[model samples]
Target chain A: MRNSKMASHLSHFTHKTSFFTSNPRRPSPPCMSVVLSTAPTQSYWASIDAQIDAYLNKSIPIRSPESVFEPMHHLTFAAPRTTAASLCVAACEPAIHLMHAAAYTHEHLPLTDRPRPRPGIQHKYNPNIELLTGDGIIPFGLELLARSLDPARSNPDKILRVIVEITRATGSQGMVDGQYQELGLDQLGSEYDVIEYVCKKKEGELHACGAACGAILGGGAEEEIESLRRFGLYAGMVQGIQGKNKAGFMEEKIEKFKELALKELESLQGKKTELISSLVEPSLAAVQIS
Target chain B: MRNSKMASHLSHFTHKTSFFTSNPRRPSPPCMSVVLSTAPTQSYWASIDAQIDAYLNKSIPIRSPESVFEPMHHLTFAAPRTTAASLCVAACEPAIHLMHAAAYTHEHLPLTDRPRPRPGIQHKYNPNIELLTGDGIIPFGLELLARSLDPARSNPDKILRVIVEITRATGSQGMVDGQYQELGLDQLGSEYDVIEYVCKKKEGELHACGAACGAILGGGAEEEIESLRRFGLYAGMVQGIQGKNKAGFMEEKIEKFKELALKELESLQGKKTELISSLVEPSLAAVQIS
Candidate 1:
């Protein structure tokens, strides 16, 4: 469950990563590698979440055949991997993650070749890495993700520019940023149950904002604007189904999702002619540029 | 945390995944992954596992997301991605692993602009992958690791082979094999916690056999044979660490591991003396080979 949870999150990452990996649009290792360490625990299973979160801010354990005793020495390291490389790295992210956990957790037997000595703590262990640990994990992997994806300010501007311009055509306020914010407060089950409530509130604001923006983007064409409104209603209905696991949907989660979807389609079809009329008719112009 | 965990386990699948993603070299993932889907409660988690296993064998939730939603339809088959030239593909062992997981888990938005409908399942309802059933897991990842890494067959075949060469390096009398067997049982924790025990028995046999084989590989020289014995002992001590995790460091376990390491060193030193003797005694009938 905990581990699979990682897979679920990572699977999305792989898709986003594949686009960049095969495209050759960014640096070779686009991933933002973040490594952290923590103290050992009595129950390896229970501490899994803390272990995982440590990838960006603390330490984690890598259980291995030799890990329990005569454990391999901690080999965790943080590095500035390029976004292009990170994406390419994302394709193989699962593998890197395993070694990352291993490199951090194994702590008794240092490889004969390595010369570093830090007892009980996993350090930046890889030779081919340039790592930095800040005051904390405030920025972590997210910092890398943001920087790597920014086209206008890309370090190697052209490569990152292409990555965004090509696959991430969601434009400014679509799924990319929206998704990141959702992940933040969505850790509802652990210590941050409050995050779920906050997320729901934020989501509501986003919906309202989305409706206004869509209408504006459509130039206030009444019918088209209405269609956008219908879509929002429809989305809310669909979302109700998703909210069941949380606290959103009470009775008809699935049914509501269906009803909303159908209603939106019907509403859109009904307003087809009006939308066309709006598309053709123009409001009076205040001044002529010519 | 969840995504990292999944990536961690999946990485253990190795079997030709990008070096950045997986490594059987770190076996923690499989165990961690299972831990995620199952629960500490034991009963509930077990049932969840069964459900997932069933899903693994056959499709469920009759209406799935793939055939129904095809959420990314516009991006997948629309304007920019229309032509085949725009797509890229890869081939590797984990390539199949990836394909299998996708085949089982992927629910539709669009594969090729076709109507694959799921009655209700929205694969991307959450930003993460859904656990169709609580307990289900993909087994191929482990197989991939084994096929790719045949310990019996590495660059220097001696160290490459898993149990075979290692056993042979130990001795023909099976003494070395027994030692490895003890350690194999003590591998990392998992639902299949005791598999290590079985592996340990085999490893013991392998070591004894491996040492004997190693001796043959060495020329018929007393010094070389002694060195091979020492190597086997060192390897055995390293392996014994695995066993300690289970039975723990009982006095016997501590004594055995320590004694074995010392014995290995003793053999190495003996080899050094034999090499010197060979130089002094011209016709010393190369009595031992490592």
Candidate 2:
């Protein structure tokens, strides 16, 4: 009974076309890549928030035992702006696709991965991050995924596959592995190869994984899934490069990945491909400003 | 390629039964429950270690980017004694079951949950836990579940179902939710109701969830799974009663739960059930001493 209510609540958010109005008047900095497109779409951003609000409302059960859930709520719900999970969910508008995308994005976005904020500050605090504890965001994501879908209709095996994919993408073999590499690198002094390696593993891995999740859950063909996986990987690589000095280089790499992602989307050759293109186009745009 | 190799290595651990010899005549205090049975099983414990070693050896890729995987290696490979996941796997005594069992156990055993050993110590350090960060243990379980059984023959839907079950079991609604109830309670004066709630949520929830995982993964009937889940919950409730002064009550509760669990197992009257019974009996036995 609750499941149907939850689905209905989510359906309302997904179907509201008023949420898709793209804004053309927002200011753009000179370094913004072509992927950014023409003005920032306030509605697209609103859709992201709406999607997250609906996802959380329908997913996380707010009840007693405030201790366990409070941290998660604070970490996810109390955040000021957007989260990777929200971005992932918004990119894939509805239901199963939203969940897999959010889970993948949330799984890889570590609280401890951010740079220390201030000089000479022994304790670096990020309001956005609640704890450095292990995979804190994932349980929230998993809970959302589990609750968001109706068990009677959804395939459990596909759910497990999504879990496996997200876990692997965020696990020791994927994103965490990258964080491990970068942990004390400042003390060791960063080399170009090491920096690139860190960027690929830590930053790029989640984005790539999120993109692939959408592809897989959206019922893309095997070839399409593979292509999106590659697209996500390259796009993530570009997003991970954050230094202001690296803007030119980042733009160059972003364009390369953008072209690659577009080319991959072209392989599907159907309405499904068209829907996926819709997801990828904005994702590419977000990457320019990411 | 690596996937296939991983499957083979795991098979080697599960096939070796030399690890199950029980050692009787081990020292037991007067408070030790009858559920402890006649003897201590040293070999079974060894089997747990061996299984985890095989799992870690096969799953973690130790190559360049030593930074990423090393922390995971240390946390998983260096741990002493048997873990819940391993016990879960060992009880099943099979390769596929081994992975999911171990993974679920490892995910919820948070490092911060420990009570301070010294009265006045400001910082109590546990070497066993290394924060690879972000639901560190889940990936291992997901990997194990993913690698367990064959993709060719198994239903993807069923696999997904297992993932959903396990994730829910460990997520806020299951384990973390319990933890949330317990958090900061020490600061507040411990009320009896609060204590019981905390105990149920923090300690019992995972055990109950673990039992359910094994049941679901082992192919137990819906009734059997419900029975085991109830059995686990009751057993966990009993186990959560920590003070030695409450030992007698705890024993009675444990016995009641064990009987209930056994009755649930009895409901399955077929050859397939025999396999599940093997897994549950020892699990019930372990709960007495848990």
Model 1 preserves the real interface contacts to a fraction of 0.00
For candidate 2, the lDDT comes to 0.45
Per-candidate TM-score against the hidden true structure: 0.18, 0.66
The residue ranges of model 1 lying beyond 4 angstroms of the native Cα positions read A1-3, A11-74, A77-85, A89-91, A97-290, B1-290
lDDT of 1 by residue, A1-290 (tens): 13233334433333221111333344222221111012222121123233333432322233332222112113323321211111122212222232222212221112222234445444432211111011001111211222232222223222222222211111112222233333352333542233333323323222322332323322334564455444443443334224445544334543553455345435545222221111111121111111
Candidate number of the best lDDT: 2
Q: Rate the local accuracy (lDDT) of all candidates.
A: 0.27, 0.45
Docking class of 2: acceptable
Candidate 2: where are CA atoms >4 Å away?
A9-42, A78-129, A132-136, A146-157, A185-195, A242-290, B1-49, B78-87, B90-129, B147-149, B178-183, B186-196, B236-290
How large an RMSD does model 1 have? 26.9
Model 2, range A20-129, lDDT digits (tens) per residue?
A: 12233422111100222223444445555665566565454445545444445444443334222332342222322332333333333322233333333222122222
- For residue A243, what is the lDDT in candidate 2? 38
